[model samples]
Target chain A: MPGETFKEYVDSFSYGSRTDLFFKWLKGAAEADAEDYIQSLLQELGEVSDTGDLSKFFEMTYEAQLAANSPPGEDPRWKYEDAPFTPLSKPLSEMRVGLITSSGHYVEGEPHAPPELSDYTQEEGTKHIGEYGRAKPFLSAVPIDLPQEKLGVHQPGYDIRAAQKDRNTVMPIDRMKEMADQGVIGEFASMAYSFIGLTSQMRLTREDAPQWAERVKDEGWEAAVLVPV
Target chain B: MSVGHISRAFETAGTPTVIIQSNVYRGRVVVMKPARVVYTKHLMGRPMSAPFDTERQTHVLREALKMLETATEPETSVILPDAYRIAPK
Candidate 1:
């Protein structure tokens, strides 16, 4: 095994063998040095060169490497749900519209909730991924007409320079108004909605999203647009 | 992931929603079948393209709004004409 990289050893095995070995490594690493485990795991990603092989490896290890507590045998595939449909009741120029985004937006001087970070711990022969804090939802919506100076964004990772320069890139509330003035949509709803996109907890989202939806429906908006970061 | 759920929430609440996303999400959106999707070949964060380029941003917005009007079936999508080319700093 001298001078052989992780990927080299991984590639020597058949598909089932590789998967079994990957889980063994993942679980053992979690029980040993979690930080070094993640670091070494990421290093192997750079050694694989083929897109198809890389993608397969990623799919195989997604939860084991990331959310180590994900229940085994559960498929993480994005399940398609037949969402309820509503046709445009009128022409675009005559519909009242609202905006929603997962770009971590909130009004200035207002409190915003942060996403729950994973708390990983190793028990005897197992990893215990605790249900940490709840993902903070900006439960209140904002007026679409709010001035750019009065708004704030807390999303990290992606470069925010462009968005800070022009909030239209993420929130687009001002652009929504301009569209209203131009009759592309009849009017902008009095308010728009935002949520931080970093969380993995679906329970909190399931609770918060419907609250906002009730408000949007109450506001009588005929259509809305979801802009994701 | 959250986008599709929220879109479904809006649609279920009787307000049809059009999702504006980057081309990176084409497969996911096609699978989830939001009421309508308008994708831009722009980068991830700047869905409407560059800042202050109101013309291009507006073009993207108009295209998204147009799909809301003209898409005849569920899972329909339109790709805006803009392509993202990252410039060296």
Candidate 2:
């Protein structure tokens, strides 16, 4: 009866399940009451739900949430009339390749910390959302050889637990190194660049991205693989 | 997406880039129009592959890197045949 009551209470929310409510909470939606109710229900049930199911729920609801929250009559997605083309001038085996990831990864003791939204209550999160996009875009250079144990991720946009377990899930630094050693590609760039994926696209396009491009060029990287999470 | 914008910036600056993106954003990726893209059916947080699936991860990386040499023009995109599903225990 308790389990049935808990399930019924969870299904009462607009999103129709506790998992959806959990994702709404994760995304900083103003759902404090729902969050509290879900937590209490979990406590009452005394059962730990499968995280894979939670992740699946988040993926299913993510686009709908974005569509619902977007301002009317405006397409928030980016579009370009033409894509820039820069052909590889040299053989793959002879070029220095680098990696750039929107994984929000940083080595332990690094100066950067991606935005932390999970600690905020719903009211505080609502206030934080306004300023979230304004946060300056930054790139952290992670060394190619850094141990996996030292890697950390802080992107607020998605569930970061997989990346926490194995950063190669996002960055693939180990895979890159293996390729470089095997000559599947040229030398690996000394550093792999990373940034938080949930920042203002306008600032990134107009300002920070160009600078980062310059940094990539200046570093003599001929090609790059961008892994977006 | 930030990766799309950054890839454009990099390519504009004479550095070619290949984007390994999740297929869920294929529509968006087409509009954003980076130099090259390889769409995989992996989950959002694990673009390369599922965690600890080293062989698949390496394969994804290698395939994306190959596009750097093989792509002739901008907006060259491919959807990888690979898919990720959790194995039943």
Candidate 3:
């Protein structure tokens, strides 16, 4: 049983899988005004790929993470427009609230928070999310009036379709686009919130939620809400 | 589908389950188990194009769950067609 080699580790994911399009803007992918920045990334690393040090992987992980954590607001990696800036015409009691959480998958040796709130303090995760319970009211209201299938579209990234682990994931995104294109939105953006994986301080989410919030705003949704979990 | 209906189905079938809908983002297969289930693999990236192909995602999830064969209920596949659970988990 030879241990996994550095080359083997790198081979696990394709550039598309490993690369963060939002975090790293390449000139090609999503329209003009975009360019690949891999050259500088390589030059900074001395363009050495075969480094056998596993620690380099950790360093790279952290470096990529840091770049993601504190990115510019104007140039966000999250792929969503701001939620429309309309304060909920209906009060919190009247409007439906959506809760987005951060604890989903916690693989072996992967990062995860301890159960207790105090553990978050010890873990220093509270830095990004001040209080987890602030979002309770919203979480409490889920699976509300909206049709289960229609509401399913809101939790786009969550395992909406995994009802039996035997079929597909939620309302198809392509389907959603078609629905939206077909005037699915009676008067508002049909999809309210896009709950991209909620690793609060993580890069992907930092880009995901803010864009969702903005999308909620831009879409003129009453409130594409989220509650800390 | 209500989480209750999902849970009841599993209960009646007599399996320990985490019945998540791929569209149920909070409990989506990708979000719940991103490592096992690839994101993009979901229906042409209907959700997001982050992971692999849908067939590949299903394959990986099924395989990963297979590892828990000895474990009770044999971790089930939560992702499925966009339909309602007769009951909620």
* Best candidate (score: lDDT): 2
lDDT of each: 0.63, 0.73, 0.28
What is candidate 2's lDDT per residue for A72-139, written digit by digit as tens? 33344686788799998989999999999998787777744434543543234334544546677757
Better of 1 and 2 by DockQ: 2
TM-score against truth, every candidate: 0.68, 0.76, 0.23
Error of 2 at A176 (Å): 0.2
Q: Which ten residues in a row have the lowest lDDT in candidate 1 chain B?
A: B80-89
Ranking by TM-score: 2, 1, 3
- The best-first sequence of candidates by lDDT reads 2, 1, 3
Model 2 has a clash total of 0
lDDT of 3 by residue, A32-103 (tens): 111222334454456345553333432343334333333343323222222111222333323322222221
Q: Write the per-residue lDDT of candidate 1 for residues A52-137, one digit (tens) a residue.
A: 23433443343233334332333345556564567888898988888888766778877444423212111110211122223445
- Say which candidate scores most in DockQ: 2
- Chain B TM-score of all predictions, in order? 0.85, 0.92, 0.29
How does residue A78 of candidate 3 score in lDDT? 24
Model 3 segments beyond 4 Å from truth? A1-133, A137-229, B1-52, B72-89
